[model samples]
Structures are given as structure tokens and as C-alpha cells.
Target: MRFTTPLSAITLMVASVKAAENPIIGLVDRITSISQDFDNALEDPNPVRIIETLPHLAYDGANLVATIVSDVTGWKNPLDNDDQLKTCATLKKFATTEEKLLTAILNDVVKVATLPLPIGGLIGLVASALKEAVDGIFGFSVKIAPVCSDAANKDKAALTDLIANIKTAI
Candidate 1:
């Protein structure tokens, strides 16, 4: 009974750890973290500070895309990035062109985006997932149209052209 007790305890620990370490679960946590960071940055008075935060946010976002693609392809996320990193670079470039406007856009995004970063199938279901994840990260701003709505809503435009462009890059 003593031996069995220790073995059961170990098994429970391992199972709990495994459940917590599930990559999709990790992905969801990461989404919430980035959303909080972006929201906090938006509240700051300085937009340059916000710019500093954007790259890291974008990279994490890329990693999320990579993770999703990897889930589908069985390759490591590093290999099957689906251009998520490139999308980050593009965002950096876009920010450089107009920091003030981009900052406002990001603020709007933080204000309106739904969280937990959707993960629809990457191939045919790309639109829904990207609309929720990629678009949430990089689209839906005051400058862009439609603002925010339910991801599954058919009548409302969930993603702007910017959203589509970023999703394409990723």
C-alpha cells in the first residue's frame, strides 16, 4: 500500500503536468498574455514605448501561427512557420512608416479584439481562425472598417483588408 501510494501520486503529477503542457493550451495562455500586454501598452501615454512592445507581440503572434501550422503538419513550428515571422517584419515596417497612426490602430485593436486566439483548421478553415487570431493581432482598427464583432458572424465583416494581408503573410 505504501508503494502504491507513491506510484499513484507520481502518476497524478505526471498527468497534471502533461495536461498543463499541452501546446494548444499553451497557445491559448500565450494569446491572453499578449492581449494583456497590448492593452496595457495602449494605455500608456507614450506611443514609442508601445512601438517597442509591438515586435515582441508580433513575434509571439508568429510563433502562435507556427504552432498552429505545426499542429496540422507534424513538423516543428520553426520549419513550418507559414510566414508568420515575415508578417512580424512587415508590421515593423508598417509601424515605422507611421508610428502615430499605427499606435492608434493598435489601441483600437486592444480595445475591441476577442481573446483566446481562435484556431480553426489552417487550410480550408483559415479564414475563421485567422480572423480570430491573426486578424485580432494585426487588424481591426479605427482606420479600418467594420470594427469588431463575433468571429462566426456571417453578415458582419470580421476581417479588414489589413487582416487578410497579415493573415496571408503569416
Candidate 2:
């Protein structure tokens, strides 16, 4: 009886770990997809349009993150049963937190992309500067491959491929 109880407990623990990993994997996949979309947008001929769309994209990203957090954290307010008030409260909270993070990251990307190049010789230097600026703004190291380089030469296509790869990884 004792041996059976211990074995059942170990099985339950393993199942819980697997369940926890699914949400984490989903979050990582969503972030990677959003990153790739942003990168592809950067490569568009009308980058200004892409920049203008950042807020909407950021909001969507934030919503996804908040939903994931709510699921993982099992957050429930007593008012949650009241549909309208619950949604408004949740949105307010999410906007103040996850939305802010998403907006910051998006704004950082825009700032980096808008930096002026001083001279012809400093193109690569500018890209490096942009990378560092993004890192600083996001408080995380953002790996931005040069658009002209072999690794990321086909910018939009490469980003698409990368998104697929990241999704597969997750």
C-alpha cells in the first residue's frame, strides 16, 4: 500500500510538471511569433506603415500575455462573475502591466530603427548601435541580425522561416 501511494504521487507530480510546461511553451511560441512579425514588418518597403501599426500589435501581444498569465496564475476576483465589470477591471490591470511591457518593447524597436546614419562607412555601426539601443530599452538582449548579411539576407522570408522554427521548437 505504501509503495503504491509513493508511485502514484510521483506520477501526479510528473503530470503537473508537464501541464505547467505547456503554458510556458505556449507563451514562448507567442512571443517568438510576435517578434518575427515585427522583424518582417521592418523589412517592408513602407516601414512607416509598419511603425504606425505598432500600438495595435503591442496591444494584441499584451492581451495574449495577460490571458496566459491569468490562466497560469489562476487569478480570480470576486467581481469576476460580473461580466462587464470583470472585463473592465481585468483590462485596466493588464493595460497597466503587461501592456506597458509590450509597448516599451515595441517603442524600443521603433527608436532603434529610426536612428540616423551619419555616413556611408557607418551603416554596420548604425545597426550595432540600434541593437544596443533595443537591448537597453527592453532590458533584455535582442539579437538583431543585419538585414544585408548572409544569415538574414532575405529579411521577410528569413523572419518567416524563423517564426516557423521557433514555433517548432516550442
Candidate 3:
């Protein structure tokens, strides 16, 4: 009976940790999805609605990323911290540049989104430009392949380490 009680308590604690981790993982998934969708939308000829929608989506995703980072750090509200504020400002600037590029791409798409004929050539040009713009702004390739790969595999380990660091701090 004594051993059972302690074992049950340990199980409960493990379950609690898993539960906490799930939300952070879900947030990461959501961010990745939004980013990929925005990237894919740039390749469509009629992309204005997506272009218009992307800023808010990206902002929401960023906010979620910040929240998860803060949570993993055990920081009550890292958004209010000076360093985090600076990071947010930087992210906002990059996001603005990305939006501008996407808007330009969408301009071409807007001309053909509803059209029956394919606009593959124009879309290809705009996608290339958009990729360049995003790379310039973010200092990384805008290829979804690398980004999604990192997000799926590398990010989990990184987040796990981050949480461990936070636990040590506490």
C-alpha cells in the first residue's frame, strides 16, 4: 500500500508534465501551419485575400511562439521584458517586409486568381521575388522544406532543452 501510493503520485506528476508540454507542442504546430500556408499562398495567382489575411495570422503565430517561449522559460510574461520586447520589434520589422513582398506577389495574383487560364509563369516570377525578399528580411532561406523540417524535429529538442533550463532556474 505504501509503495502503491508513491508510484501513483509519480504517475500523476509525469502525466501533469506531459499535459503541460502538449499545449506548447500544439502552439508550435499552429505556428508552422500558418507560416507554411502563407508561403504556399504566395504561389497562387489570386493571392490578395491570403496576403491580406497573412499579417494577422503571422502576428498571432508570433504571439503564440513568444508565449510558449516564455512558458518554457518559466518567465511570467516575457513579452513585457526588455529583451523580449526587442525581439518582438525585430520580428515585427521582418514581418512588415514579408507582408510588402507578399502584397506585391498578390498584386500579380489578383490579376488572375479568378481567371480560368493558368498564370504559372507570373506566379513563378512572383514566388521567386517573394522568396528573395523573405530571405533578405529574415536572413534565412524561405524554402518551406528546410523550415518545416527544422520546426518538426529540431524545435522539439530545442523546446525540451529550454524547459529543462527553466526547471533548473526554478
Worst 10 residues of 1 by lDDT: 140-149
Q: On residues 67-142, what C-alpha lDDT tens digit does candidate 1 reach at each position?
A: 5555445523331243333333333433343233333444455442333322111211322333355333333211
TM-score of each: 0.37, 0.33, 0.31
For candidate 2, write residues 68-159 as lDDT tens digits.
54553452322223433333332233224433333343444445445452222222222232232222222110111112123222222333
What ordering of candidates by TM-score runs from best to worst? 1, 2, 3
Which residue pairs collide in model 1, if any? none
For model 3, residues 54-96, the per-residue Cα lDDT tens digits are 4544454445445444444453332324433444343444344
- The whole-model lDDT of each prediction reads 0.37, 0.35, 0.38
Candidate 2's displacement at residue 89, Å, is: 35
| Residue pairs in candidate 2 whose N, alpha carbon or C atoms collide under 3 angstroms | none
Question: In terms of lDDT, which candidate is strongest?
Answer: 3
Q: Stretches of candidate 1 above 4 Å error? A: 1-23, 75-170
The reply for model 2, stretches above 4 Å from the true place, is: 1-21, 75-112, 115-170
